[model samples]
Target: MGGRVSEPTTKASQFVVAILAKSGNIVTLYQLDVNNAFLYGDLHEEVNMTLPEGYFTENDKQTEGNMFISLFVYVDDIVITGNDIDEIKRVKTFLNSKFLIKYPGVLKYFLGVEVLRNDENICISQRKYCLELLNDYSMLGSKPANTPIDLGLCVVCSPSEKDNLLSNITKYQKLFGRLIYLTLTRPDISFVVQILSQHMHAPLQSHLNLSFRTLRYLKGSHGKGVRMVKGNELSLKAYCDADLGKCKLNTRSVTGYLVYFCNSLVSWKSKKQATISSSSAEAEYRAMGLTACEIIWIINLLRDLNINVKLHVELMCDNSSAIQIAAYFS
Candidate 1:
């Protein structure tokens, strides 16, 4: 028996970024927990399933005048926030009448992300999550490293290195999965995690060791996280960079970009280019294009939240030739 279910939900990164962008304002954030969340979704297709002995026991957006409200849903967990307090309460009342829900007073924690706010700025971290992960892997006692990965360390396993393949792939997969989620708050390890993920299909012992190194780095920098300061201008600035032929296995360039709303970092990525570029200029141009797309998306998101980008979106790249090409096109 098999089935597929899909729901519209806000991405973790998108939700975090949106909240950060509006931090220090008169906004209110709250969490709603739905009981038996999975049992409530409408199934589009029919499928077979083995029912448990007590299977029958399971159970499960709007805006106000001049008010902006955002509802983020991950399955049954709902985070409601807006500038209008009355509207938020009305939403909760309406939702509670439809299904069973527990209203958590504030969003202190959700999906492993811990939210902390001060008078000046809002900080998000996964310190508890990191500690739990380290303890689970028995790496809590490991000496902390200064960096997530060794500089100039290329994780390339050749045919002659077949013997170096990890014997148990499940352990590596689980650890890697956790690392992937950790990136929601730990952008510092993003590049290394992106590199490690490429080898999940066939991880080598060396890759496992490198994963350990990431854990050790996490040990040292667990307190580090994204900080969103209040009163920053709602302007977009981006920086895009590329390392030509950085992927040792495929010879593809790596593209990295960081997008900020004023002083707060909202979006960033470290990824390998789809195809090989003949020149560093070409690689850098590709990165610029990707960054532009992200900027456009962020602008639209802000527009939906009733925030306008009045100033020009600044996209910075170090490549002179690539900058000239972009300017000429404009």
Candidate 2:
């Protein structure tokens, strides 16, 4: 079928992590591989495809109904999670009967991210991926940087600096794409990656240098990852901030927010705003609005999963003027 096959959202990983944290030490995570998962998905639109080789539609029938075990599928890979061991086993057995499925006992590695589980906590990291990236750029042995970006470094769209343009545009684009993917588990470099991504279309030498500096920073903290510990509380808390006129060329402010479910860091974003704000208070208010929207979305998602979120979700902002503006507007 030429129709769109809706892939699982990238936030699936974060959600999985949050669930694991909520379950504490009693969680059971099963990794699965379906020989041809796409073929399993019930086609919404009529897809006329000549049977590939030996494959036939007669043998493959679609199954519908509510699944007891919670499953998240990303193309071929699937993560089956639940507390009820019998239910998990039953689902696995059913899938095996229908499709050629391989059940990996525990989720150690999936989507280039590694998972380490102990009695107390679960740790997620992309150490192997980070090392491979450094080696690809011949920066494995480079001195590590303490920070992703230099304290005084200012990156902007410099069209007049024609001589500073990167020689190979494709390479710059490729690096940026890889780094962006790396941010899935590496939130430490999220802000800098967001900044560099803005100039992917016309990357200058300064941009490339900053990207390298980010790589060096990754080298220093290659083993660092997010650790989700067992916690009794399932509180939803968010913190948001803004930098006024952070974008030197466009004069647009940057909004950054981090969200936590209980003590687990579930989501975060660092992006430049579309509209220009005249004052710092206005910028801060905009950031708050953006964060509130995210909170609402997350709350709805949790509700869908049957996890009740605390009615009063905490949203924290440091700016007094922004608080006043929000209170006034309310």
lDDT for residue 158 in candidate 1, whole number 0-100: 55
RMSD in angstroms, all models? 8.3, 7.1
Give the worst 10-residue stretch by lDDT in candidate 1: 56-65
Q: How accurate is candidate 2 locally (lDDT)?
A: 0.78
Q: Across residues 1-330, which tens digit of lDDT does each residue of candidate 2 receive?
A: 101212344364345544554356355677898886767768587543222444535434342112224566667787777646888888899989989998777888988889887777778889999999999999999999999998867886875555377778899899989999888778889999999998888888888888999999998999988777776676788999999999887899999998887668877889999999999999999999999988877776554444567778888999999999899988
Report, for every candidate in turn, its global Cα lDDT versus the true structure. Answer: 0.82, 0.78
Candidate 2 pairs with clashing backbones: none
What are the models' TM-scores?
0.89, 0.85
Off by over 4 Å in 1: 1-7, 43-65, 159-163
**Top candidate by lDDT:** 1
Candidate 1: tens digits of C-alpha lDDT, residues 48-152: 332234544334112222665677788888888877899888989999898999987788888888889978888899999999999998888899999998899
Specify the poorest-scoring 10-residue window by lDDT in model 2. 1-10
Off by over 4 Å in 2: 1-7, 10-22, 36-42, 45-68, 159-163
